[model samples]
Target: MQVSIVGSGYVGTTIAACFADLGHEVVNIDIDEDIVETINSGTPPIHEDGLPELVGKHAGQDGTGRLRATTDYDSIFATDATFLCLPTPQADDGSIDLSVMETGATQLGKTLEATEDWHTVVVKSTVIPGTTEDVITPILEEESEKTAGEHFGVGMNPEFLREGTAVHDFLNPDKIVLGADDDRALADMHDIFEPLVTKSDAPVVEPDTRTAEMIKYANNSFLAAKVSLINDIGNICKEYGIDAYEVADAIGLDDRISEQFLRSGVGWGGSCFGKDVAAISAAAREREYDPAMLRAAVEVNDRQPNRLLSLMDDHVDVSGERVAVLGLAFKPGTDDIRNSRAIPVIEGLQERNADIVAYDPVAAENMRERYPNISYASNPAAVLDGAAAALIVTDWEEITELDAEFDAMTTPVVIDGRRAIDRRDGIVYEGLTW
Candidate 1:
């Protein structure tokens, strides 16, 4: 299958490379000249594990001629299928702003008007339930002046790829959903994913377009709620002088609860969980439905950073001291700090007028854009030098391996939000949730 992916962001670039690797001729279409040029020159525009190797192998001058990128929307007409991986960024009121995606769809439809070939359009970006069928398909039909089912096939196939492990997750997906309004569109989707399915042996779910969109939201919502629930439990365990990990481990033995998202800490902070949860909760409220549990889960997530800061306050006064912050990325293996728990932790430290120095080998540059005044260290040990208190926000391996670095701190008071470091003898250690 010839696959043309629109919007060469994280999802677009990743899937394009993976599709090419899966033996499909792929062309990624984006408006950004820099991204298109980067991909054309055999490099990835964004940071992701295993992405460079994949892009290098299939694109550019030295690689196979299976994958490439272009800035023209007309490029989609040359392909048999197009996946809309454009952004659906969140609005201030928690609803997703679909203006960007709508513009892309309109352009795709205009370019698609010239093609007589039966093309399948798949919505791979995360959107609300009726977005694909109602918003996208209507725009496509209007711009192209062609009927949806008869002229062009429409489908909704949401992506579940995580930030750090996008390549691994795409190649080894838990489930593959193929959604379509018609049989031809569904069959085309199967043809596109058949090779991947045969290799991974993942289950295939056939559903309508609306159900597929809802699945993405529901999946993230459940995991976000689970994390908050565990954090909530951890808070209670702390009040009663209990080890939250022990309680979590015992409960994890049950098949129903499982062990995933059981590690309770500062809270989940990334592009997906918080955005998806908020969007879905707002969507529910728009229908006059009060999703109390979901809203409460968000509230718990919001307060966890303050809770971690309060723990640090009990150990020492950091107002006039050098406070070292370890790990600024939302998680390990990525440079994204969009909604990192470290943001709130840093904000709390700022409120108290703590002289801050933070370290994350990969994400320091990105965080520098957010906090130019604060000091950034070249290494974790450097960040801990002469610090009064150290706050662990991300559980990066380098931050976790600091057994004796605490001795460098003036106060030697360590407050861990992610339990990155263990409690040792030489330093006063505090774990946010044990």
Candidate 2:
């Protein structure tokens, strides 16, 4: 099967590579000239484990003539299946700004309108319920002048990928969900993914489009809520001087709440949890329903950054103080900083008039782009130089090497946001809520 992935993001690139590895012809379309050029030269634009290797292998002469990269819309229409992996960024009002997704779909519609060949449009981006038939299909019909399932079929196949583990997750997905009203569309998608699923023994579920959409939100919301719940428990334990890690250990043994996203920390950041939870809460409110639990979960997570700030304020006066933040990205595995807590925590300190110095092993390059006012350091120790206190927001392994060095400081104060540091002594270490 020939597949065209419309967006060359983390999800899109991995999907294209994985499909190409399975002997399917995959063309990735992107507007970025640099990215398209990079991929055309048998290199991935972004970093991920096993991605560059797979992309290089399949895109190069060794594996398949199947994988290719392009910016041409004509190339996109040439495929039998077009996968929408575009971004559905959030607006300020918390509603998902489907502008990018809609624009891509509309463009695809125009292409399909002019094309003579039949094709199936699959949405691999995360979207709210009813987006497929209600929002997406209408645009396709209006632009294409043909009804869906009559001329071109449609389906919603949302991606579930972690940034660091995207390639592994794609090659060995827990499940492959296909949601389409048209049997032909579903069968086509099944054929495309059948080999990979069979090889990995992954489950292939054929749920309704709306159910499939809801599943993505439900899964992310549950994980976000669980993390928030654990953080809230950590906050409560902080008041009573109880170790949240110990408490989590006992709770995790219950089999009901196994140890995933249960770590008490400065809260979740990155692209998915924060935006998805807010968008979902907003979507629920629009439908005349209140998702109180989800709302609270978002609230707790939002407050997490400030909580770390308050913990830092406890150690020393941040006003006119030199403070070093050890990590900038939301997590250790990637350089994505869409909604990183480190941003807010740093901003919160800045509001208090602290002289900020920030460092991250890999994310510093991107963080420097996002924040120009803050001081950029060469290493963790460089950030800690002449600083009154250091905050460990992200638990990158390099930050742990400083545990002994930080302990030797004359006035060392380390605030662990993710509770990644605990046993280091001599330095004034404060774990936010733990």
Best candidate (score: lDDT): 1
**Candidate 2: tens digits of C-alpha lDDT, residues 162-204:** 8878988888888888999899899889988888888999988
Q: After superposition, how far is residue 297 of candidate 1 from its true place, in Å?
A: 0.8
Please report, as a residue range, the 10-residue window in candidate 2 with the lowest summed lDDT.
401-410
Residue pairs clashing, model 2: none
lDDT score of model 2? 0.86
The best candidate by TM-score is 1
Local distance difference test values of all predictions, in order: 0.93, 0.86
- Global fold similarity of model 1 (TM-score): 0.99
* Model 1 lDDT on a 0 to 1 scale: 0.93
Over 1-434, each residue of candidate 1 has an lDDT whose tens digit, in order, gives 88999988889999999999999999999888988899999999989999999999999998798999998878777788999999998999999999999999999899878888889999999999999999999999999899999999999998999999999999999999998999999999999999999999999999999999999999999999999999999999989888898999999999999988899999999899999999999999999999898999999999999998999999898988999999999999899998999999999999999999999979999999999999999999999999999999999899889988789999899988887777878899888886
- Residue 357 CA error for candidate 2 (Å)? 0.8
For model 1, the stretches where C-alpha displacement exceeds 4 angstroms are: none
The Cα RMSD of model 2 versus the native structure comes to 1.6
TM-score, cand. 2: 0.96
